[model samples]
Target: MATLDLSAHLKEAKKHGPQARGISDMARSLVGSEILRIAGEVKAFAAQGNKVLDLTVGDFSSKEFPIPQPLEEGIIRALKAGHSNYPPASGVIECREAVRQMFERRLGLGYPVGSVLIAGGARPMIAGIYYALCSPGDKVVYSLPSWNNNHYCTLVGAEKIEVPTRPESQFFPRAEDLAPHLGQARLLCLNSPQNPTGTVIDRDALSQVCELVLAENKRRQQAGSPPLYLMYDQVYWMLTFGGVTHHTPVSLYPEMAAYTIFVDGISKAFASTGLRVGWAVGPTDVIERMSAILTHLGAWAPRPEQIATAELLNNGPAVDSYLAQMNRNLFTRLGKLSGAIEALKGKGWNVDCISPQGAIYLSLKIDLRGKKTAEGKLLRSDEDTRKYLLEEAGIALVPFLCFGLAEDTGWFRASVGAVSLADCDSFQARLTGALEKLS
Candidate 1:
């Protein structure tokens, strides 16, 4: 049977009438990921057969950084065993128990399995958290340069209380800075071994923030208002380095457990992004609410991957061995990039980077604003700086502006996930020649 060609009608509909506002207000207003948009451009640039070292997406190149061997084997085994059915909305019971046991064994935070709700990676958990907790116009306090808090707030129609952080504090919000925002906010978000910046919050600083949360909850109790919730996205908690340790609110103060929800997954920690297994650990009531939200969206992890991840996380020795090797490889990659950037700084270039502490990123500042390119065009913004580097040096990076930074900050995130140490070393040679053309 011949199908009617509807493309012309659909195109005409878009030019006038209700099709202009056909999408729901929320869907229409939602802004897509800038990080992803830039990553797409980088991919297109590389597809042209250019010698570009892409450091855009916080994603692993499976060739260089494969998922743990045990996890891979388990996935194959599970698939062979016919574990292909839809998993329970909350996840497989075994996997939830495994996450609970792993957290207790590894992070020293013990909780019943019911508090854990599994989803298709951590993104669903974040969206579920926003959907579960926030009403329109409620305040959500998150740090600047945070991963996706702004987008989440917009999705849920929450008021954003942006806490701008300085480089001195590693782009982490101080307790004092967060205190004023938390009093009336519905949610407070924190990330450690933080994305984009690769900075870890010290124990003392984290403790103070925990204390602030506790105090805020107390005020809420007296005022007969709902208690504030804290969503601690520790997806990169396992990726710390350089003698810095990762700390958690609940780990510091057990009282904060009532208000703190931990979002974690194998995606970042185990280099298993494609596995689609992650869990939220928090109060049972909140987890249930989040579960309801996710269930409607069908956001549970795949059964085979969940079963395989359970097997992986439950084995302490395997997890330890994988992390040890993983950290060494990541350390080497980060060291190459950091050394090259620092060398440029030493040569009096307006460039700098925070020493890598954790995560697959290094906070690099290519502060070339106001400088004219060799083509006699002035670099006016981070986008200009990004394009200049890509066109000149063939080095691709994601600017911090993509990470909710609303200014012309020179900061960019250099993720060492998709490239090799050799690819990283190439940045210095490429960048040094590129910078020479600047006035």
Candidate 2:
């Protein structure tokens, strides 16, 4: 047998490097994740034996917060029972019913089992909504500083209408901000206990949004146009703190259920991001459409994991117990970080933070623009500010610009999901020293 060596051909191709050739327009136009890029730098720094408190990625460090005991055992038992086969393309019946019971029991939204569609995680469901509803060039309206909506829009060739939000409203689009665009939009996206910000929308604010969506869909129906759909991403719903409550559109107006698709999963709520179980609850017809689209992607959750998730969801006592403790642990760290930042602000450090509200994040503002570093380098943009913090303080963070803020506002997301109380304590000391090094 003889083998031909293609080393020369491979070298020539490698030497020329990639020119954007022959790829789909979407692939060519797609932007990479700045969060991951920053995280990569953090990893490299830590790899050099440098001590860095990595608060960049929106993920839990298993050591800091492991998945729940029951969930873990359930998976083990399932595998022992030989549940290794592919789950139904939609999901196992047991898991779907559990989700249905969960909605009615926890959220008070009564729906048939057909309304729930299971997937690998909330991402596929989100992508499914975009794929199932919007044609090319159809408009998708979402707030700025949101997670991955821009990339999804690009994936489906949908027109993007990003509405700018203010810090006062906690980075959530108000009814008035979204009203003008909804008439033309095919889908509207909302996430509460929002990623990168950790702010929960007030019930009144969410109610107003539901009303707006209702009115818009009503108008579309009258005109014989396709109904506008709402994709509510509530993956962090179970992790709220500080007396804040998580609200939903369907829960507010029962009629709104006809147009809402709720995205939820065990990732954030159970510290089980790697287990890959997620689902959506929506109108049965809409759920069917999403299923038809997502089925081709093989996006259904694993059979064993689905069965295990169903067990966990039905275990009300276990869920409540876990969440109560989880919330306490999360709030402890988030509060500590926020308090430390506030103390720095009180001392006039040009740093400020929103008090911890919900989710594993704290919205921090560290304005170092025009300030001379010890090396006389002027920090001019958010990236510059981020770099200064990461390099000098060894505290990694994801700047709001990465989340599509469009402005160099010096704001950043510091996630507590992967850090401990001690880690959070370390943040204050390092942040203070770094800020002091700046003029």
Candidate 3:
């Protein structure tokens, strides 16, 4: 019997397993999330017992900001009622009807229940949108420094046409910025109260965009080509601050209803990111296609969570109260951080920030490039500046590069969803000290 060299055989097997084999070309071409990569670095720093203020993730800390009381309670009630079964492919009827009502009551947009498609979260819904509407080689236009649109395009093998937005536009794509590509694009993706920048599209600007989309669709119809579809991701619509009102394409231009698909969910608004519930509202045909794709993928939201979210959305008073408090807490932290950055700018420090108008993010500018640190290492890029801030100030944030901006862009996104008011204050002091060290 060959009881031979078991350790060596195990080593050989480990070296040549199926898991070590090459992946598909599509998988090979994909890039891992840069935000999560940086998050790993922040986690390493925190693991050393140091207090690191991590703002790299676009998520909530359940401990800092719990999901709404009604939502939590509703989930409990649902589970107790044995709602653990598989949900309907589109969604449980109760939840879909609630979403339909939510649109009518809140946004003044009347969407039929059949036009709604609920999924595990916004990501699956967005992916379904790509799979359903965009074919390989189709152009998908989205502004740079936005969220995961670039990755979504890659996954679906679409041609990415990135329109670089300027700070002057509050990092939002203007109609003029999008006009050149609309003639050729199959999909136009827009996010407002946009992620990473926390800026909203005003009524006039959004109206203009809707007009462009309508005009392009008209042209496509005449040419007998497929109409260009708009993916309006208003996930953070409910988190607007100050006087910034969220505008939807359908509200501005009724003609756009034929072309616009809205992606929304409780993940952002209700601090329920982990709850895995999101929805899309759009034309019946488009939504039906998305529902079919989601059905195959089994991306339905959990039955219990969907029931809970429906209850939460339908409870007008509970919904209003939760949003009011959530907005207040988010605004306080964002304002403090923005104010601190402004103060640094006042002292001629190379720091500035865009005023936070909505969402839980503040776009901060740390123009430390070409500046010498106390240790004589010259910060030459955004990555260098990010490392200096993390190591020197304990201020961890995601740079615009992670959001698909150019590597030299000095902007960074500081999310306050997981941080406390006290943490912001502490970060301000530490950041001030760190800036003072730059020669």
RMSD of each: 1.4, 1.6, 2.7
For each candidate, give its TM-score against the true structure.
Answer: 0.97, 0.97, 0.96
Off by over 4 Å in 1: 1-4, 17-19
Residue 287 lDDT, candidate 3, scale 0-100: 96
lDDT of 1 at 336: 91
TM-score of 1: 0.97
Model 2 residue pairs with clashes: none
lDDT of 1 by residue, 383-406 (tens): 999999998899898888888878
Q: 37-88 in candidate 3: lDDT tens per residue?
A: 9999999999998899888879999988899999999999999999989998
Per-residue lDDT over 359-395 for candidate 2, one digit per residue giving the tens place of the 0 to 100 score? 8999999999999999999999988988898889999
> What are the lDDT figures for the candidates, one per model?
0.91, 0.91, 0.91
Candidate 3 positional error at 317, Å: 0.2
Give the poorly placed runs of model 2, Cα more than 4 Å off.
1-21
Q: How many residue pairs clash in each candidate?
A: 0, 0, 0
lDDT (C-alpha) at residue 235 in model 1: 95
